[model samples]
Target: MLRAIAVAVLAIGIILVALVEAPIPAVALTAVTGVTILLLLWPRSSRDSVAPSAPEPPMADARAPIEAISDPLLIVAGSRVEQANAAARKLFGAHVVGEDVRVAIRHPAATDRLAARQATADQEPIELAGIGGRDNRWQMHVADLAGDRALVHLVDRSEGHAAERMRVDFVANASHELRTPLAAILGYVETLDDDAAAEAGTRKRFLRIIRDEAWRMQRLVEDLMSLSRIEAEKFRAPETAVDLAGLAKEVHATIRDAADPRSCDVAIAIDEGLPLVAGDRAQLSQLLHNLVGNAMKYGRPGTPVTIRASRGPGAMVRLSVEDQGDGIAPEHLPRLTERFYRVAPSRSRSLGGTGLGLAIVKHIVERHRGRLDIRSTPGEGTIVNALLPIAPLSSNRNATVTGPA
Candidate 1:
């Protein structure tokens, strides 16, 4: 640019000397034009150097993607939360969006980790309790992002933890149930063996007791095996057609003698033209037996224990067992179907209940593509209703078998 300016100046001086013979106004105009040309033709970059840098393709808001994610996620800038996803809002609160992450999260370890400049990748995940309530459990994981930003992912572990606790409880309960009968049988056997002076009647009575205890233990083992098998085949939906009305009557008749109906009246009611349900016949029969047996055993003395079968909505069969007895409390209704759960442990044991009856019934109903509903009011009666899909008359009913997946 300097060389161009010098050449232009020399040319302008020669132009003025040549134009000295010309008018002074014309010479002045010519010099002005020359300077303008030199300046306009100056060397320069193609791009507009003065314009601001192409405004950063607007930092593609990562929070948008996190909003669509199912897991709870939070984006934090320093100690404050810049954004929270829908799940995060639900787990915490909508106000958490602009709050301090440590305060919003309400966890000592997690808050400390977030506050620290450095975080350990191998640090054990901090457990968050009572996210929604005391029954819930969640795990928090924090990861560093660019520019003092961090991402926190929350995983809910409530269901898994509850299932694990239930497993542990089931094993313990089964062990205790099995041990009771075994101990009774062992004690009676030893007594009979050591006492030679035991009278004939006494010996016979002790033998009866031993037999009863052995049968009780045997029943428990059988129920446990049955429960295991049912769970193994839980995913397998039953396909064979079984008449539920007939099964209900058969169960009532089978248990009529043992029901000791002096204090309870066992009755069966059937609605005509009931559709056949697609299910495992043996399991369905057992389900009916357990329900009716429970009804008869628990119904108040002289009150009617009714077993009814009728057509349900949408091509379904409704089989119900109702007992007029001291009803169960509202709290016990939810856990009644859980394995080894009994409302009255001692009463249940004396009545030869292994506490797996309702649980078995539940599995069988599930296998049949059915729904079971239990309703009871204190001092009134309890009703158990099982709704099962009617077997399709056409083919393709057994296209695929569902089993535990």
Candidate 2:
């Protein structure tokens, strides 16, 4: 308001001076009037037209925060690389910043989907080959930002996918294993029932066959249940201190009593003063039993099977079952702990093996935070070693040694 009044007064003074024809005042007023007119009427300069303009909107920094994330992420702007997170840099190298989205990712499917003009705002999984010959999968989401820009987000799914595949395979394999024994039991029982009216000798043979099949089926069911329990309780270790030497002796006696005449001679060599292992006594006994039994079953007749135990590093006790049987091939050794996996399916079946023994042993050992090692050479011998962590034997719980056999 003050400025407007001053301007009005100046204009009036200029008009009066112009009318009175005072040369000095008239010239001063005229000069001031011309300056004011020029200030008001000069073409308006555009504020946005200035050089070195202001910074972009906050949306431009939308990707700045995500750059700190550890997981790979990409900011795609119309099929072009707008920005990439730190993880993406580490994954694809720093040269990917301005590179084409397709060329940078190097995955045809991912790139093609990203480049599709009609692509919907949906999330899809894309698998790609990563460094070091590893396979990587990403859950990709395409979202539209302001203007023609779009944001592509990547979430790793490789581990999740692998776990899902393993679960499916485990279910399939377990079902097949259970079905085989069930089919045998059912078939044999039906036959025995049909032949019940036959001669005494025939009836006796049928009954024996039925009994064997039933026992085999029972063993299979028992092993399956044992495996399930082991897996369920695998996260917690047993709170018992089991004597290594005593357990070995018991297992040795049991195996010897039950051994076939033609089977290998079972021997025990437990180191004196061997530390007790922390484990469930019954589970540990079962573990030892399975190992010794496996060795005897697969070992060559007239050979020797040695059960040895000694103090291992880190307060651990190592128990090993060594057999002079035809050793498993290298290809089959890795999978020996898998449920129902057999090196020689036919021969193993003939030997009355349920194939869940080693699998159960593995779960038990792992529950105690122990390691199981299988070392073998074809035609030589196979050794199964279980390294169990030992707890201090003071007021700690004592592991009961369930009788072997």
Candidate 3:
């Protein structure tokens, strides 16, 4: 196009020169027109031949349909930032473009791997700080793009890591708890078998020890089964309306009769007009039985274990088992609900505790959407409070309560 325009201007200049009668003026005008034509037709390279070539637009600009991704994408040229997608822009900010890859990402591990020229596939899991948020983990991959350009793709792995860690911890703890009972049972049985032909009294004592160990193992297995069942049925609430006061009375009566008649004293305080609770009748009975039985076994021989029940606020009933016995310290209180966690392991084992009683209690209370509180001081006593929501009374009968036993 420039060549055509220059030819037209030259032809006009020649025609104007021919029409003029003056030689010098026409000759000067012709020279000037010719120079203008030359200037217009000259190639750009002749003027600034040393100037550098302008860089090509990024390859990501004309990317394939597969490359037009919704996931975040980053284009890197060596250690420099070349381009970033909209998702990457939102994640790292718009200012990240044209900045050094290391400075833009602000993660030491990522920068170090890029600097070392190690392929990302061989690099350890690199923790990226301030990329998405503090807790987010990103696994990076480096792939070769056109020419020297490289693509860095990140995958979020925070949730996967957390789940794996939880699985590992659960397995370790469960195995440890189970091993304790198995080891004891195994050791006792081995000893009994080896010394069975000895003295009659010694053999009898060894046999008794073996029996106790077997019972302990049995209790642990049973508690595990019970926990599994409770977890499975936790979503469904009990269909029956349980009389909280009467249940408390039944538990108290059973415990009182079983108590040493001459030593331990049992007292019951079921306030009059206590409302019935919404709970499983059998589970509630077992809950009360466990709490009271724990108190009796651990309470001092002459001290009294008091069972109290009263109507609580918000259509709820509160039952408390208070025992005058050696209490738990503050540090041990938090872990009392963990399976196989005991304040005094030796004492708990001697008392034939499966170490799952408190854990079971916690699960049951949670299933009922109720609250359980344990309060204790080192030398005073411990109180276990179980609160359950009350069922509305039927129109025909008022809520009833049994008197103290």
Candidate 4:
């Protein structure tokens, strides 16, 4: 009857811990349950032979319950560490068991909070920067316990901090991008409004500039929308099979039909009998167009912009786009996929590039569970390869297949 009660109480303690932030009560309950089990399971003959003088210390009994927690937890009695869980030991060190809590943590904000003498009803969490490493962020929550003891819970906030930084940076960059073109269009329109600057030649030049800026804005908005859409469906890998050979030819023909001067220089080389890859058809089409369009914009006039598709190793299909132009510097290659990161901002703008082509391509590749590799030499030119897995036999059966041209 007592063992059953101990088990039920232990179960209740664990469930309560999950539902509340105050682990001290649960920890005490857990310690009591642990000691109860030990006393209940003692040899019946040994207990009958002699009466015990002192009960065993509960500190040893508390280790099992605390060790089950995943996050770093420390029980600080006064200024010194009473006990630490496995996670805390792993973080601060095995030697931190008896060390001062302030010395173990070693953060100004955390130290200040720990050293405070006045007792408060509620202790607010303190943010500790550079706790374990330079980029690490930790939230320190302290709960007052009996006998001046405190429960210190350290939650890693590094990933959340980084994601927030990225969101802020993205918004800033996007605003700047849109603002620049809009300013230009507004400036040109305001100048054209003046009779003095409204001569036939001047008016025509101003209107042309305005039209180009409008187109640039349009492209940026479209690319931004496309990126959002791709990110929204990133976890849902497309099960439909797409024909690489036909898609390559279609993208090439579309480019050929465009009015861009470098369109004629774009070439397509697709391997015969290439198996289909599982991917979204519309996204795949956009991916092809972005790759081919970027090559056309950056490659030198009258130079070849080759798009090749072939069966790759590991049952994957390799689609590569090569451009004959002054290649990107080695240092810039790694960050090329970051949005609004341009090697030559002025040059990119003049070429009508929205600075999102590679970023879009990257998200598209990620959504398809594919790999993107960009290889370049300063003078030799650049080539980008995307490796997409071939559709499985079962997926192929249900895939929407396109006929070859």
Candidate 2 vs candidate 4, TM-score winner = 4
Whole-model lDDT for model 2 versus the true structure? Answer: 0.70
> Candidate 1: what lDDT?
0.76
Supply every candidate's count of residue pairs whose N, Cα or C atoms clash at under 3 angstroms: 7, 1, 0, 0
Provide the lDDT at 303 for model 1. 87
Best by lDDT: 4
> In candidate 1, how many Å is residue 289 off?
0.2
TM value for model 4? 0.80
Candidate 1 — which pairs collide?
A: 235-402, 235-403, 235-404, 236-402, 236-403, 263-301, 263-302
User: In model 1, where do residues sit more than 4 Å from their true spots?
Assistant: 1-60, 115-117, 122-124, 257-264, 393-405
Descending-lDDT candidate ranking: 4, 1, 2, 3
Clashing pairs in 4: none
Instruction: Point out the worst 10-residue segment of candidate 3 by lDDT.
Output: 396-405
RMSD of each: 21.5, 20.9, 22.3, 7.3
The estimated TM-scores of all candidates read 0.79, 0.73, 0.60, 0.80
Error of 2 at 120 (Å): 4.7
Order of quality (TM-score): 4, 1, 2, 3
lDDT per residue for candidate 2 within 158-199, as digits (tens), equals: 767677777888788777766776787678678778876778
Candidate 4, which segments miss by more than 4 Å at Cα?
1-58, 93-95, 393-405
Q: What ranges in model 2 sit over 4 Å off? A: 1-67, 89-95, 106-137, 143-149, 192-197, 262-264, 393-405
Report the lDDT tens digits of candidate 4 across residue range 236-256.
678787887898888889898
Candidate 3 lDDT, 59-176, residue by residue in tens: 4422321123334556777778877766677778988778899888888887776776444445454555446786677776555544456566665566666666756765676677
Which candidate leads the pack in TM-score? Answer: 4
lDDT (CA) for every model shown?
Answer: 0.76, 0.70, 0.68, 0.79
